[model samples]
Structure formats: C-alpha cells, structure tokens
Target: MIVSRGTVAFMFEGSQSEVLTEFLVSARSLSEYRAMFALSPRDLAGRDILDCPGGAASFTAEANRVGARAVAVDPIYATSPNVLAEQALVETERAVAWAHHHAERYRWDFYGTLDAQARVRRAAATRFAADVRVAPERYYFGALPSLPFADNSFDLALSSHLLFSYADRLDATFHVKALLELSRVARQVRAYPLLDYLGNPLDELVDRVRKELSTNGITTSLVRVDYEFHHGAHTMLVADRSN
Candidate 1:
C-alpha cells in the first residue's frame, strides 16, 4: 500500500487504487507509548496525565495501573463500552491490514513482523475494551481544538497520530488551536510523529504550529524519540506553558 498526500493507496496483484478517507483509529500499547514519547518511569509515576484522541489504545489503562492518574478523552468514548470495544476491534483489523499492505513504508525493527504488530494491537484493544467497561470514569468524551477541562488540570498531556498525521484534513489553524488547548489543560504536552499518516514530513506545519504556540505563551520543541514504526517518524513535539 502507498498513500498520496491526501488519499490512501492500495495495490493488489497488479492494480493500484486510492481511497480518500480518515486514518484508522489505532490501538497502541503502553510500551509503544513509552517509546514514542520517551516516557520515563518518573513520567508515569504519581502524575496526572491526559491522552487526547486516545482511540483504542491501552495507554490510559496501563499508565494508571503503573501509578499515573491517566484519563483518555475522545468523542468515541460517548458510546457504550461494548459498542466501543466492537468498533475498536474492527478498526484494529483495518489498521493491521493497512500496515501489512504498506510493509515497506515502515520499520520492522520495533515489531519484527507484521504479525507481531497485529498481536500487540489486538492485545491492547482487548485490554482497552475490558478496562473501559470496568473503569468508565477514566475515559471521557471530547475532541481536539477544545476539551472539557479546567486550566492546569493535568501534569502532562500526550497526543498521538491525530494532529500531524491527518494534516491533509486538519489545517494549520486547527493545529494551532489544538496545541494551545492541550497546553491550556496540562503543564506539559507531548505529541508524536511529526509527519502525516503516509510517512510524509510536515516540517512546515510543525514550524508554523511551534511559532503559533510560542506567541500564545506555549514553548515548543521537537525531540527525538526511540520508537520508529513509521519510517522517519522518530520525533515528537513537546510543548510547555511558559513560566
């Protein structure tokens, strides 16, 4: 599979096709989040954290288990746990298939094989399903550019695969607003993969967003991380409210 700037491309046998659509909601694990954000033990211990557009990921569930007070906010959380679990599994399968199809576009070192990637995602989705059912309060209904939280509500915020990954659909203004909002609720905010879903670099967009953030009393920087499932996606944007 290969995707153009605004559409996903799929090639079967000899024919190639493009589909204009939204990126699949991903189910990343706590381990994956740790690497993607370069999270340290201190980062997850006794700290209040927010995961925006959390999708089907088990980060919130796992983070809380390890001592962090983590909460996930996504519009999809409005649905019942059973329904969201089913949707999570379906989206997980789609994401796995897409990743396998575009095998060449990713780095296999992190997952070893496409099968390993699928297994991790499935497990994460299952954990997310069970956790959301038991601890529904940990998950909230919200979206980007806005959130239902008071100022400095969290010690840190983690956002993944929603901002730059869908730059094709989310514009510069939206990115600026979203970053500012995240900064509003957390003392520190970290967003991973400074590229679109197709592995395309978004240097211009990142720079623009950083400039906008700085003007709003938010300081931003690009930090290299240890994870790189998407080739060249080893950097994360870290934003902090200026003291």
Candidate 2:
C-alpha cells in the first residue's frame, strides 16, 4: 500500500506476519517499550510526519497522539496471496480504528499488560467488524515513485527498521537511493535500523548518511536512542534540506 499526500510516498510491509509482531505490540507504548530511537522529543505532537514501512500503524498511532497529521504508507496495505501471514487491508483499518479510540492506552496507559492490551485489540477488531472487510481510508491504496506530492512537502518523516529489512539489495548504492527518496520529500528525516543486523558500525552508518544527505543538499545529524533490545536502538538521523 502506498500512502501519500502530494509528492511524498511511504512503502510499508504488512503487519499480519510474525516478523513485526513484537514491534507492533511494543509500538502501543512506543516511548516506554522501544525508547531507543533518541531523536529529540519522544512524542511527535503537532508535527507532520510520514511513516514509511508503517507496521501495524505503530508510529503513526503515536504521531496521532501529539496531534500530528500522519500518513501510514506501505506496499502491503491489503495483502498478497503468496504472503498469507501479512496484514490485509481489513487488518490495517481495524488497527487504525483501535489506535484512534484507544489513543491513551497506546500512549501513556499501556503498562506491559499483554493480556489487557490483547483484550482491547480483540474488542476493537470486533467493533470495527474487521473480520468481514475493512473500510478503505482515502489513503489506503496508491501508486509509488510517483509520490503524488510535491518536493520538500513534509515537516518530519520517519522510517523504522525499513532500510535493512525491506531493501532487496543491501548494498551501499541501494541504501543511498533509499535515502535520496526519503530526503526528497521531507524537510527532516529519522530512520530506525537494526544496524547490527547489517554488520555495520553505528559511526560508519552515520558517516554514510551524512555523505548521502550532504550530496542531496541536506544536512544530517545522528542521535542514538537507548532502548532495551541491543539492536533495537536506532540511528536517528535528523536531516534538513539545504535546498
């Protein structure tokens, strides 16, 4: 599913798969559960944010708490017949409704109560009648590369565990292209990565980002979030377009 406003587009993987189960559950209380993305303030209140690779609408949910106009983008908005476990359009809509209704639970009310949260999730699922079919949000289905938006359109954009996990070619060139696309649409960018999974040092990753953003006429700053999962920490890069 590709979600966009004008020139910005976000590509997300679905949430039905177990690959992102832990992250999605943790995202309910993104600050407390996954506090490692140290990028200035924890909350995105009043900011315009782009959430790419939007898993279970996790970050988007948080962005909504702070009154941020958030767009959740992903390729797997509905699902592919081949990927049986991925989130379908119905699932995504259900999650979004739950997030909207239980904003407090996902924000400050969440206290690692797996059972309670699960119960709420289940209830929300029923209320939304997601078991049948999900109602399409205006932004649910869209095309890619053509972001349907103009340049330098967003105030802030974030991509968590997107680069390393979603890229087909894990080479430097691939990363550079991905960064370029991200920088093209946002005034500021922050990305979360499981760096160790890439076998790349944090400093090296920072340097690469700096160089890439610099070439793209964007200045970059890297901040580290202190989270529990060793690899859960993120190399949060704040980028401002020089153009």
- Candidate 1 RMSD to the correct structure: 4.4
Please provide TM-scores, in order, for all candidate models, with all chains considered together: 0.92, 0.58
Candidate whose TM-score is highest: 1
lDDT of 1 by residue, 1-243 (tens): 111121122322333313326556789999999999999999999999999878889999999999999999987887898888887887777778778777888998888878888999999999998899899999988877789899999999999998898888789999898889899999999999898878999999999999989889988888999999888999999999987
**Distance from true location, Cα of 86 in model 2, Å:** 7.9
> Whole-model Cα lDDT per candidate?
0.86, 0.47
Report the number of clashing residue pairs per model: 0, 16
Model 2 residue runs over 4 Å out of place are: 1-36, 39-43, 78-146, 165-168, 194-206, 231-234
Judge candidate 1 at residue 131 and give its lDDT.
90
lDDT of 1 at 243: 70
Q: In candidate 2, residue 85 scores what lDDT?
A: 19
